[model samples]
Each structure stands twice: as C-alpha cells, then as structure tokens.
Target chain A: MSSDPNSTSNAAAKPADGLNDVHTLSLVVRDRPGVLVRIALVFARRGYNIGSLAVSPGAAGGFARMTITSQGNPETLEQIIKQLAKLVDVVHVADHLEHPPLEAEIALVKVGVGEGSDRNQALHEVALEFNAVVVDRGKATSVLRLIGSRDELQAALSALAPFQVQELVRSGSVVMDKGRSVLTDLLQKS
Target chain B: MKASVDTGAQRLIRFLEHAGVEYIFGLSGGAAMPIFDALVDSRIKLILTRHEQGATHMADGYARATGKPGVVLVTSGPGATNTVTGLLTALMDSVPVLVLTGQTPTFNLGKDAFQEADVTGITYPVVKHSYLITSAQELPRVVKEAWHVLTTGRPGPVLVDLPKDVTQGPCDAPEPETIDIPGYRIPSLPDTEALDRAATALGQAKRPLLYVGHGAVISGAGEAIAALSDKLQAPVVNTLLGKGAVDETGPLHLGMLGMHGTAYANKAVVACDLIMSIGGRWDDRITGKVDAFCTDAVRLHVDIDAAEFDKTVTSHIQLLGDARRTVEALLPRVRPGDTGAWLAQCQAWREQFPLTFESPDDDHLRAQHVLSRLNALTEGKALMTTDVGQHQMWAAQFCLTRANRMWLSSGGAGTMGYGFPAAIGAQFARPDTPVWAIVGDGGYQMTLCELATACVHKLPVKVLIINNNYLGMVRQWQELFFENRLSGVDLEGNPDFVKLAEAYGAKALRISHPSEIDDVLSEAIAYADGPCVVEASVVKEDNVFPMIPAGAAVSEMLIERPTEKLEKPSGST
Candidate 1:
C-alpha cells in the first residue's frame, strides 16, 4: 500500500494490488417495485460508485436482469455482493471476477464531418477500422454506432477523437458466461 | 360461489388475528383512522403510546422479550417519520418488528398532500423489506409476505405503507395458501467441513475464549454455549446485548466485554490465544482499534449473516449458520482443550480486578452502588431494560441476567428514550415476571411521557432513575479527555421526577442518601398496583471506570480516574 495519503490515483489509494480493479456484476432479481433503488442503495451505502448500469426484463418471467459496473476494493466488493444477495428481491449475484465473462458494450459517436475532406476521410477510415456503421448522417455531423467489447469501444473512440467528436454515449458493459451454462438456470432448478 | 368482500383495513386486522398477533403498539392519526376503526372489532389488543417513537421502542422491546415479531401501526407523515429511530434501533439490534404506516391516497402520493410523506423511501435503508399497497386486493399477499420477511433469516424490522384510499376500498382477494418469496433463503445447517476445522482449532488451542453476542441470545444458544465452555474449560465473555447468552453467575462466565466492560473480561480478550465469536458482529464498541484487537488470536466467527464475515476483523474459520445449531453440530466433533492454566489465570485476574466503586464519606449515593443493590434486591430474576449512557454500562456490569431474552437494551443504536417504553413492552410480553427500566436522568426525560401509557395500561414496571445532573458519560469524557472543559453535558433546572411521575398518575419514590437506597427500591419493587418511579439522586462527576477510551485498545483500559493529563489515543477521530 502507498503511504502517500494525498494520492487520488486509484492504484495508490487502494490498499492492495487489483483492489481498485473495475468489476462487472450480474444480478437476476424479481421484477418488483423499488428493487432498483434497493440495489442502488446497497452500492451507495458502501461508497462504491457505479461506473455504469443497465437493466432489462429477463427471459425468465417475473424477473429482471441487471448489469452493474463499479470499482472498489475486492474485499469490500465481496461484502457488497453478500449484502446484495441478502435483499429479498435479489435472486442471484454473479461477480465476474474469477470466470471473466464475455463482455460487450455499444457506443453512439456523433462527429463533425463537414470540417474538411481530410478530417472526414480520417473519420471514415477510423470507423472502418473499428467496424462502426454510420447510423445517421446530417449536413455537418454523422452518428456512428459501434458494438464491441469495452476495450474495443474505448479504442474506437480514441481513434475517432481527432475528428471533432461532438457527443458520445456508451451503453454499460453487459456480460455472460462463455459456456453452455445459463445464468437464469438456477431459477428453474430451485 | 360468491366471495364476500371486506375493506382493506378489515382484512389487515383479520390477517393479524390469524397470525396470532396479541398486541399492536401505536398512536392514532387521521390517515390510519380506518385501520384503527377496524381494530375495534379485532382480537389483537392495541396499546396506544404518547409518541410514535415510544410505540416503536415498545414493539422492539416486546419483540426482544418474547421472540415474536412486534407490530406497530401509525399514520403517515410525522407518525411514520417518528418511527425512524425505533426502526433503526430494531434494525441495528436485529429485532423483529413489523411497522404498518398509513399513507395518503395513491393519487396524492407524489403530490405531497396533507399528512403525506414518502415513508417507504425514508425507511428504505433501515428495514429488512417494505411494501406500498396501492390496491385493497394486495393486502392479503403483502401482509403475509411482510410477516414472512420480518420473522425469518436474521429477523429485523419490515414496514408496510398503506394508502388511505386502499384501506377504505372494498376487497375480496383470497389469501395466498403459501408465501412465494423465492429470493429469500434461510441457512439452517453450517458447512460440515468448516465446523470440523473449527473443532480442530478449538482442540489445539491451550487458551480459547468464547466471545458471545446478541445472535447467541436470539438463537437461544445459552445451553449450547455453556456446554461448549464446560467441555473446553473455556471462559465466556459477552457483548452488551449478549448478556443472557450464558449464565453470568457460572464460574467460567465473565461479564460484558468492551468499553465499560469488566477489567478481567477485557484482559481475557487480549490474552486469549483463540477466540470464537458466535452470533455477534465485531462492533467497533467491542473491538476498539480493530487492527490491534485480539491480533495474536486465531479467530473463528459463527454468524447467520455472511456479510459479517471479515467485515471488521478477519476470521480464520467462518461458520455460517444459526448460532445454536452450529454450536450443537460442533459439539460431537470437538475435543476438549487443556486450558487449566488459562482458566486459573483468568480467574486470578477476576479476583485481582473486581468491578467495584468507592464509598464516599459524604453519604451521597453512587450510581454503581444503587445498581448493585437493585441487582441484589431483584435476585437477578427481573427482566431488565436500560437507556443509554453511564447507567446503562453500570447496569450491564452489576445486573446478572441468567437466561436468554432477560436483558434488553439498545446496544447498536443506543437510543436513550428506549428503556421505560421497552419495560412496558416487556411487561406486556411477560405479565408474570417483574420488569425494571434502569435509566439515567438525561435519558429518562426523553420518553418520560410513557408514564401515561404505563399508568393507563396498569403495567407493574418499576422505573429506577439514576439521577445525576449531567449527561454522565459525555461529562466523564469531557473531564478526562477534554481537560475538564464541559460543553453541553449539564442538565440544570430539571423537573422534580417524583412530581412529574405523580402528574402522570404513577406511584413515585425518591432516594437522596445512601441509607435510603434499599428501602426506596424495596418500596418501588413492592408497588405492583401500577408503574412506580424511584429516582435515586446520585453523586455528580462520578465516572464509570474499567473504560477503554474510544478507539483505544484493551491495553489502554483505565480502571480509575487519572491524576495527570490524558492524551488522545491514535486512530481515534
């Protein structure tokens, strides 16, 4: 652990190596009112900031699948997972720490294209390299939608940063096991 | 076939009756009128309290005493808000309480109508779970689910907010045959491999200590703990709420451990080679300076809540299950340790540093003396409840609780106004047993209005007030750590407690001198016609000793007042 108390950098602030590592947690929860607030409160109370979150109705009836990304000490994250599991609305909590699930995210990047031919050509080249498709093209701006892994999306955004990027929005990472087993299978067996 | 219809309020009351709820503690308000009216014809008795906070504490006390989920009913807005403290008290202590709060009509919920408040939102963090009923048809399912959630798997408080429109509306909904909470799971058995490891650790340790907590008391693990202690020849020290987990009078039992704990108990914690904590979280109060607490000991923690494992202090072996069941399972697999030397050392410490106070020549009563006398007079049989601060610690030191659920205090939240009302609740739960509320002058004034509730209900609870004209605990800290620079600790111009009790129609007594302690306590205990108040005017500036200053380790415990200036310990904010 770094003894420098003033260090705000994640690595120095954390007590142990990989303590500040970002983690994605998948939860299968009941489709009940206030379930989101309860789950969010669990993170908020522990001072763990959620980097991103995405939720949708689960394939299993009367349930919801939630994907939350947050960064904190792994010891504290273990406790957070246990606390989340204790919630009555939460069915299962899967921390993608050991298994390292297959993760993906989507981003819509709106860039200024009418600046010049050179800049526009450069943006198109970057989009092609990242396999991003032009979803909307306006007179001066073009919206490119990219679907890939989180790192790929980040690389694509960095590659397109020089073309006067106007606005960028990215969906939070969603994950699944890279095997035949399903996350919702436990619900059926229980 | 035609189904008969009833209003939501009627259905709620019927559900309570079906669940064998004997009492509901609450105050009436406009939004809850329908439910109150429905209660008029129900079998469950309603005990009206002066304040909603008192009602919640009463319910908490009742739950702690009876091991049944206590029920609370109050209106929306302020009524719901007032129960926050009591709910927090129950939540921190893991008491099972069900709070039913009235809400404004569903349409007016977000509009901020009269007597409106976001009750579920405000109480979200404190409750085990909560519900907001928008339709009368949902009452049956919500009530049953609420009870199930409140009573199972580490019991805690749950709230159900009812909108007035829903309660007044007609309902013909059928009760669910079985509760369908698939997400909730209760662990009944501990992992056998983990228990075997723990038993092995216990067998190898020459010096092992059982650090019990409220979980043991809640799980009724007294006999099992006693058995384990006897088999291993280990000494037992308990947390404040863990008072009755084992017989305090037993030869191997040490009193409460931590700040204001017995000196010998704290010493045992520091000296033990192996410590097994059962049903008790390693609270900051118990483990001062967590890194330094029991550092050399091999920790074995047993608790139903998995989140508590390695929460504050890491345990080498974590046994996840109910306290009683886990201990019973480990009994057959365990071999007794050779701890004769350790037992002798602990016993020697107990004799060398007994819990005692000096007798002043001025004849003014010492709070410690008064409490010891009360314990002797009651013969350790009375069900004792206490408010927070100096008197609370004194009571925990002197009062001998022999069985589980006999000692009830606000351990986690330490809410001051808890004692009198809790005693009332305990009286209601165990009508045959005598209940005593040991309170301080400052804490007694917080909820003294409950004197009316006790008088009206004719409860035979004895209220013993250790009247020192200051917030004794804070004042002690100010004098010791703050260079005697007093701030807001004084309680001057206080009303005469005897007169105040009389105004509330309660029998009152007073003891100003040391000679009057026995006579006054005897009179108050003998007066069983109604609630009685005995205010003992104790010496001011008296401090509780055997204290580990906040954030200081067990090594820093002070058995007496320091004659020189004191320095703040490290890691204390």
Candidate 2:
C-alpha cells in the first residue's frame, strides 16, 4: 500500500511469522454502487489477502451483508477489522473468530469424461461420503452439489479435482454466531 | 407544506437553505447552468471565482475560518478536474467542504458527451465520500448524507455530483427532513478509560510535550489545550497546520515542529519522555523517521478518526473521539503536573538555535523583516492565509496569531496557489475582519486571477505578494540537496503583478525599497474599500533557517547555512 517500511508501523505491518489462524468478518453495508469495490479495496490496498468473500442483499432490509475471510496474526488482524469499520458504507464489522459461528458453504462440482472415465465410480463414492447429491448428468459431465461446512466443501472439491473437473462454483463461507444473537441484534447495538 | 421549488437544482438550493449554507464559491459553466439558475432565487451568496480551482480553495478557506463546512459548485469536465488539487488540499488538512459538481447526463455518462467526466472515480481517493446522483429525488438525500459525512468524524471534502439531466429533470418530492442514515451513525462517545490512562501518563511524566496538530484548531479546543499546557507547565509544539492552535505569544510555546521547524521544537520532540499528540496526524514531515521521532516517548494519540489512530506514530494509548470532547473530558481527570526542568532544557535549546534570518543583501527586502512588520501592523488581529514555499515558512515563523484558527494554509498537501483565493473566502466569512494573503511569486501566479473575485465582491482582503522571482521552496531544496542544479525553477517572464491587480479593478501597490515597507504595509492594512495587492520583490536565494534537513534527528539541526563542506544527516527515519 505504502512503502512505509517503518518498524514502528501499525500491527498490520507484521509479516506472517507464526500466524496460522484465519479470521472471518461479517459486515452489513449500504446496498449502493461501488460499495463492494470500496470494501474490497480496503483489503486489497492494505496488503491483506482475501481468502474468500460473499455478498448478498439482506432479505428484509435495503442493506447488504458481506462476509470476508483472511489470515493474519491477531495483532495485524485487529488492524484490518478496525480499518474496515472506518469505511462509510460499512455499518458493522463483526469478527467471527471469538463467537465461532455456525459456518456453511455450497459448492457445485462438474466432473468431465475422457481421462477420468474410469474414476467416475470413485468420484460418486467421494460425493456420497460428503453427503453430496448428483444434481445434473450428461454423457460427459456430472454436476454434484455439496452442501456442508466450508472445510467439507473444500475437501469434496479437492477430491473431484483429480477427475478433470469441468467447472467449479463455490459459495463462499457465511457464518452466524452462537445461538439467540441474530445479526439484527448486532446492528441494533451498534 | 407544498415546496416552492420543483426543479432538481432548486431542490438542492432548498436543501442548502435548510443546512444553513451562506455561500457557494463557484464558477458558471455549461453543465452547471441549472445550479447557477437556481442561485438567482436563493438567499445563499454565489461567490464567483475566475477559476474552478480558486473556487474550491475559497471553499476550503471558508471552512477553516468559520468552522463550518464550505460549499462549492462547479461544472463538469475540466471544472470538475480542476477541483482535484483543492480537494486534495482540503482532504489532507481535514477541512470539511461540500463540493457540488455537474456531470454529464446519465445516458451521456459513457458516451463521452460534451463537458463529461468521471469525476466521482477520480476523486474517490481524495474525498471523504462522493456520489453521482442518478435521480433528482435522490439529490436531497445525497446532500444530507454528504453533509453528514463531511462534518462528522475526521471531516474532509465530500462531493455530490449532480448529473446535468438530473438537475434539469422533473422528479418526486424531496424526502422527510430527519436524515437518519441507518448505516452512518455518529461514532460512539469516546472511551473514558483510555482518556484516564492518558491523563495519568501526563500526570506522572517528568518530561512531557503537548504535541498539538490541526485537530486542536478544527475541534476548536484551543482553551482546553491551553489549559492542559498551563496545568502541566509543559512546552507546546505545533505542526504547520496546527500553527494557531494556541496563542503564539505563550511563554512555553515552541512555534512549529518538522522539516522547517524551530530547532527547539524538534529537540523537544526527541528529548521528551511523553508526547501527547492532540488531533494532529503525525505526517511524514513531522516524523522524519517514524521510529526516531519521539522514539523514547510514549505517544498518547487523541483523534476523532480511528484510522488516524496509531497509523503513523504508534501510540501507547489511543483515545478515539472528537477533539473538543476528548480534550474536555481529560481536563478534569488530570492534575497539574510538573515539567519545570524539562521546560528549562527546552528553553536552553530555543536560545541555542533561535529561528533567525540573515541580513538582507543590501536593499533586497528580507522576507522575515516584511513578515515581522506585517505581524505588528495587524497585531495578530487578521486572518492570515499563506501559500506553500518560503513565504509560508516566513509567516509560520514570524506571524503572531492571537487565537486559534486565525491562520489558514495548505499544510498537509503543500499545494501552491492556495493563499490568495483562500483569503477571499476568509474575508467573506468574516466581513469586517482583516485578512492577509501572503504568497510567493510562483505560487501566487498560479491563482492570481482570484484578485478579480475579491474586487467584484469588494472583499477588502489584503494580498501580500512576496515576489522572489523563483519557485522559492523547490529552489531552496535544490540548493541544499540537489547540488544547486536550478532547472525550471526560475520565473523569468513573471508579469507585473501590480499592473495585473490594477487591471482586475483592485487597488495595487509595489514596494522595492526597505524604507517603504512599513508605510506600504500600513496603507494596505488601512485600506477599507475593496481588496488590495502589495507586491514586494524580495531576496531571491534567502533560505529559511533552523532547518532539520528532512530526515535528520532533532539534534542535527543547523541554524545557519554551512560555510564549510556539507555532510548530509545520517540515518533515515
């Protein structure tokens, strides 16, 4: 972002020395043009690598919800969350690391024929292990939907990758913290 | 109640009226005709300027002087582009301004129609917030939101871009008055615990310094800051934008700290154990090398914006809140701390490397002398605006401002041509008050067309054009750091500034001899009619003294130009 190599730079300036933990942040923002770009830019400009991002319009309100995941040390991670909270479009940024929400993801894996023709049975076996269901099928392609936690979906996609995956569509992770505390409550307190 | 105004631009005018805007510094152009037409029937004054850049600077100046968000109106294309520099200037200085720009029609946006521009895209990085209004009904909401964004935490320039067709189109009625943006709530009240920690730290430190920044002035916490300074017996050092945050005549005041700062201020920064930075961004200029700047000190940063907190200078305690409120809360929690020995040490440093100027080379007017005389004539009663370069440093060093917010300059961006037009805005803000525009020859030429604006409005701002015949600051840098290459720094074909002012129907005077300094300045100050321009050809190569040479430590300061071989300061910040 800046050539600011100052040792006294903020916590975000720390290199990933022993950082192994990843954090997910949920944000409620105005459903306006360039809102996503502005939020994405904060992550991009500050050298924070975004592992995943998902934005969906709120069901009841005119606002939109954004869930972003990135890995950094707690020191650096807090700085990123603070920076995100500063954006005008961003209403609230709740770090899910503390609450450890019920995470879910939906992935669609399309497997092709030719090289992986013999592995069709193996792929079906892998899908069954992950509770995936075959949604579409043709002579050369098989589309399966894997609905589970982010890790389960990622493992299922990896299992099918070796079988010549024709295409992959992943719905990024979305999390809601432990029981009774809805996102609306978070918005209300803020 | 049925509204009298139905058109988009008329609705915008009605919104501004509700917002209590007094002036809209602007220029008329093809795309902005709707706004100009609406101005005819509104109570708000339209301060017409010769250039769009001048219009933005005037708005910035008005904001700084009045502590209210200044409003600007400009057409699309070049008029919108022209505001980039002024907007950057305001953004860097944290001046709140509502910039209204006309854009091409929605349908004409991507087709490159006449007077079209991607103004919103261009200013996204420099503005606090911006919008390209798609519909006329959204104008009121955008206006309300823009004002909310501009005047709130860490206020900067916000733009509400009105499409030409939208301004001309018919639309639904404006929304209800209570503009409660669900997404944008005012920041929570400041943390008292953090303030308590900061107060305790101040109470215990043996050597503490009140490092004031522009936030002190922006928050109008001059009295609170002064009270803290008094209670602690701590010396006060200000950044350039924070110049008038406290009375310059205070005994414990260290004028300014940074590249061209007083030796004592820089030395105090290095020696102090606790640096309480109030509302000031620790800009690159202030903290030469961040690690070395107040390296040993515990920084207590108080700012309204959390982004500014610990962004540059790492703070031991960050009190994120409005400047005025933060200071007010701290006033009662802390006791009168003692730093007498530290004050004495700082006094010793001040005496060791006093900010002084060499005697003028014969009859060439010394900038310092002229500034000193100006300071005395105004008696610290005038609103002073300075352009970037040597004259600005001279004013910052020599001028005595009696109160906070009395001085305005493009400090953070260091933009040239800000002073003259800014003076015009300051004059309008305080109609009967005296205002001075001290600008260098090169910077002055960039926006001298604004003299016409002052004349037409009869603003009565005193313009002090310090004609040094060169881009003085850059030339000074070239001399000290660039081996005196002196390429493209000269203003050889500069106009006769006095004649230029006279042609613009403004009173003009030229002073060359040293003897005429007092009389010419006195007459210019006494003039009660329209604006006046006083151009004095000054020493060309005179350098500002007590400079710390960019990245040098506070100890490595030089009061006078080195006569022997020069050695650059060691260690980058």
Query: Which has the greatest TM-score?
Result: 1
Which stretches in model 2 have alpha-carbon errors above 4 Å? Answer: A1-23, A44-51, A71-80, A97-100, A115-117, A147-154, A180-184, A187-190, B1-5, B170-175, B187-189, B361-363, B562-573
Candidate 1 residue-wise lDDT, B1-573, digit = tens: 134568999999998998889999999999999999999999899999999999999999999999998999999999999999999999999999999999999989899899899999999999999999999999999999999898888989999999998898888889888988778999877888999999999999998999999999999999999999999999999999999989998999988899889999999999998899999998878988776788778888899988788777777788999999999999988899799999999999999999989974457689888899999999978999999999999999999889889999999998999998999999999999999999999999999999999999899999999999999988998898888899999999889999999999999999988888889899988888999999989999898988888888888888888778887655443
> Each candidate's lDDT (Cα)?
0.90, 0.83
Per lDDT, the best of the predicted structures is 1
Q: Candidate 1 overall Cα lDDT vs. reference?
A: 0.90
Expressed as tens digits, the lDDT of each residue in B1-573 for candidate 2 is: 145447788888888888889999998888889989989999999988999999999999999999998999999999999999999999889999888999888988879899888898878778877888998878777777787788777879998889988898765665667765666655534787887888898998899999888988988878888888888888898888887888878998988988778888888888888888888888877877555677667778888777776566667888877777888888888886678889889989888878787665556788898998899889889999999998999899899776877999998888999999998888899887899999999899899988888888888899998888999877877788768889889999999989888899999998897888999999998897899999998888998877776666566666778665455444332
TM-score to native of every candidate shown = 0.97, 0.91
Enumerate the candidates' DockQ scores in order: 0.33, 0.26
Looking at model 2, residue A61 earns an lDDT score of 64
Lowest-scoring 10 consecutive residues by lDDT in candidate 1 chain B? B564-573
Per-residue error (Å), model 2, residue B301: 1.6
By DockQ, the best candidate is 1
Model 2 residue pairs with clashes: B289-B573
Error of 1 at B557 (Å): 1.5
